[model samples]
Structures are given as structure tokens and as C-alpha cells.
Target: MIEYGFRLPSSHDNRPLKFEEFERHLDKTILVSATPGKYDYEKTDKKNIVEQVIRPTGLVDPIVEIQETKGQIDDLIKRLNVVIKNGHRGLITTLTKNSAEKLTEFLVEANFKVKYLHSDIDTLERIDILRDLRLGVIDVIVGINLLREGLDLPEVAFIGILDADKQGFLRSTTALIQTIGRAARNVEGYVVMYADKITDAMAAALSETERRRNIQIAHNLKHGITPQSIVKAVKDIAQHRSTKLKGGKKSDATKVPKEERLRLLAEMEAQMDLASQNFEFEKAAELRDEIERLQAEWGL
Candidate 1:
């Protein structure tokens, strides 16, 4: 397992690893893996498996309410169902695919608008599911590992976590905090965890929740503005395009030559530089990836 560590590329450079350094390192690693003979996983005409994994971006958000586990999951669902039946949506996250599927089936058969997503769901279906949920076409989405990070839906008013005290990455303090924080994006959002005995992770999650809630409330009060619903505030989350770009346009990916690639690379570098100057690290990081994809022969 790789424990992520911060490495300064140069003494004067302060950004965490960006696409250029990461890709340059990738190229160096590929060079090392190749012998005089023929094939290598890194050198093959293939894309990286790690790049296929999704990473959603945003600040941490969740407002949680923990309950002791005497029929706690059922009770949590009942409360959440009331909110959903009344026209709001809820989310439930389990630690395993089996659990997510079972719960999704149970909820759907019980007449709630629900679906399950894991690595199994087709990419196209997943995109539709996300959009439908936002539009109120679905009331709940239950998932195992897929629900964490980068996956945002502001209309969800409740999040229920089952087996919160179970230990693992799926049940860790960071995981619970990230899951529950999904609800914090909405004004009336909240989380409920069904756990018989609270663990260290549970304790940490609760403390973090209280801290974030107080801070958001304080900010709202000081500004003399009411805290808004998650739905109302999430419009800026996705900056997706309406239609596919035509090939002749500058941003189109197909049919570009080496000259065009370098030109695009320089253009993206300027954006990266501007972002660094403005202290917008996330934007800078995105542009870095764009530059890499634009420059890569394999478009990896």
C-alpha cells in the first residue's frame, strides 16, 4: 500500500505533486521497466488503471447524527424514508457491494426510488443515475466504496451509514467523516449511523461534525444570511459541457499533430502559471492533467 507523502519538487516550489512531475516520473519509471527485448506494462499501448479510478474534488462536508445500534439501521431508514416520501432524497452507504445491493433491492421493493452503484454499473448508466437523482427522478442511491469523495449530490438531505463501528478503510474515521460530510452541503442535510458500540473512528467523526456545523452556523450568522439548502447551493458543483465539441475547435482531442500538441501544451502551462499566481491550486492541478493528456502520444 502506498501512503501518500508530500514531496517538494524544488526547494522554492511549494505545490504538491502536479501532472508534469508525476508524468515525467511515470515516463522515467517506464524507461526503467523496458529491456532490450520487447514488452512492458508501462510501455504497452494502454492507459493507466490508476487514472481510471475517479477522484472527486471539493472541501469536506457532512452533518451527522450518530445512534446506538439497537435496531438502529432500521430506525435510521425509517426516519430517512419519511424525508424521502415527503419528496426529499436520502443516501445510504454500506461498506461492501453485497450490502449495498441488498439494501438497494430492499428499498426499491418497498417502493422507494432507489438504486445501487458499484464498479459493476456501466459508466453511461452511472452518469445517468447521477443526473436523474439530482433532478428528483430517484430518491436514494445506495453504494459501497463508490460513494466516497468527488461524488456530490446536493439534494440528498440524509445519509445513513451502516456498521459504523466496523474497522477498516471502509469504516475508518476518515471514511465516516467523508461520508457524513456529504449531507453538510445542504441546509437541512444530516447523517445517521447505526452502531451498537462507538469506536475511536466514531468519536473522531462526531467531534469533526460538531466542529464543522458550528463553523458553518457561525459564518451564516455573522453574514446575516440563512444557511441554504444543499440543493440550492450545489449548482456550481459540475461545470459539464452541453454538447460534444467539434473536431476543428481548439479543445477537440482528435486529429492533432505534434506541432498542435506542443502549442496546446504551452497554452495549458500558461493557465497553470496563472492559477499558481492566483493561489488556486486545484484549478492549477486540473490544467496540469489537461497539459499531460494533450502532450502524451498514447493520450494516457
Candidate 2:
């Protein structure tokens, strides 16, 4: 499955792979994404294109609004306060990892429970951070591109896109639409683009969102349906098996005898299987990497 084909180039070692490479290998292929790229369009006929504008849950797209960048942080704080008071969470996206962390720090100083997520964070820790947000342990999460796709946080009602006028990969139409979609899981979903001027990407994203929203609204009205926020049971994978070395202490896997190390590996393999079965792909990937590392270290 070529899911999130936009990021396929950076998916492995930052090297871009030509679409033909996959085309040669498979007789039939399905490219899935909300915003399919040019390659996807070229490969598939216009008649074959399928659109799923209305969600199965009847949730409509979030409302998109552009706000002046002046004092954007202050405005975000005020908005987040209201969302938090209503027992929901917020997401803030920045242009870079440094900006995300800095914004997270500023929010913390303002007494908002917050954290930042980016490529630099460990995979397992990232899972815990998301769980904390879902459990209301944190009110806001500042992130870069990591907050876009594959995240199902129904608690997030508000999304603040900072510096949205700047046109680049992160601010492109596809990126903006995906980021704005983060709030669509909630009935009160809303998006604020903090931009002084609207870019071409911003205009397209806004227009597309409005179109989808209208379709959804029409469908819901016809069916007499009210959108409800998705309720997902938060599963704690880290609680079952933690890979972190505690308090600068050596790992048990390293200090144990060869037989004990083998046993640990077996246990980790079992946990990885469970994580995969539970649809925790990120956690399963982390466990697989850790297992490889231990196998090489212990010569098991």
C-alpha cells in the first residue's frame, strides 16, 4: 500500500524512489491519500478516481479561518484555554522542530500543560506523549509535520497553524489540508491559519475544505444525523514493556546471562506480535528495532 505517497521520498534514508519502481513490481496497485500527488493522477484514469468526502461517522470537515499573525501566540493561548475548559485538547503546528519546542516551552510558562513532538523524539516516548494528551494529562501539543496524518486524537478540537502564509512543503495545499483534518474527528472541530496574507496553497486548501464541509453538511442534514466525536480506547503499550534505561542504569538485557537474554528477546518478540495485532504499528516498529539491537549486542 502506497499510503501517504507525499512523504514516500523521505520514507527511507531521505532518498527519492521513482514511482516506476513500484509500478514494475505490482500488477495492481492502490494509491491511498486524501491529497493524492501528481504521480497518482497520472497512473489512474479520471473515471477510476473515487472520492470519500463524507465520513462514515458523519463528521464534517473543520471550519477554516485565517487570522493575522500579529500576537498569534496570545490568540492561541486564549483559544486553547477555552478548549481546555471544555475538556478537549489543541494542536499547534510550527514551521520547524526548533519553533515547535520553543512554542511548547512558552505555553508551559503560561501554565498550559503542553509538550512537543518531532523526529528527534524516541518512538516509544512519542506513544506515551500521545496517550497523555488523550487522557487529559496535557492540554496542548506543539508539533511539526508529525501531527498531520495517521493520528486519531478525537480530543483535539482546535488546531492552530502558525506562519501559514509562507509557501513551502509544510505550508503546501496538501500539507495544510492534512493538518486541518486533525480536528475533523470532533464535532466542535475548528482550524485557525495564522497568516497575514493568503498564499495560493492556503486558498486551495480553504476552498477544498469548504467544498468537503458542504458535502458533509448536506449529507448529515438529509440523514438527520448529528456528528459525534470518535471514542477510542487508549492502549498503553509502554506499560507492558519499557525499552528505556532507567536513571542511567544499565539495561537488564545487557547485564543478564545469555540464557536470560534469550528469554528477554522471546518476551519482546511476543510483545511485538501483540502490538502489531492491536494495530499499534509504531510501537511494533520500535520493538522490532530494539529486538534487532539486542540480538546484535548479545550475539543471540
TM-scores for candidates 1 onward, in order: 0.60, 0.76
The residue pairs in collision within model 2 are: none
Candidate 1 TM-score, true structure as reference: 0.60
**For each candidate, C-alpha RMSD in Å?**
15.0, 9.9
How well is each residue in 70-165 modelled by candidate 1, as lDDT tens digits?
Answer: 876578668867877766778887878787888888787778888786676643355557667877888888887755665557777788888888
- In model 2, what lDDT does residue 35 have? 71
Which structure among the candidates has the greatest TM-score?
Answer: 2
Q: Candidate 2 regions off by >4 Å? A: 1-30, 238-300
Q: Global lDDT of each model?
A: 0.64, 0.83
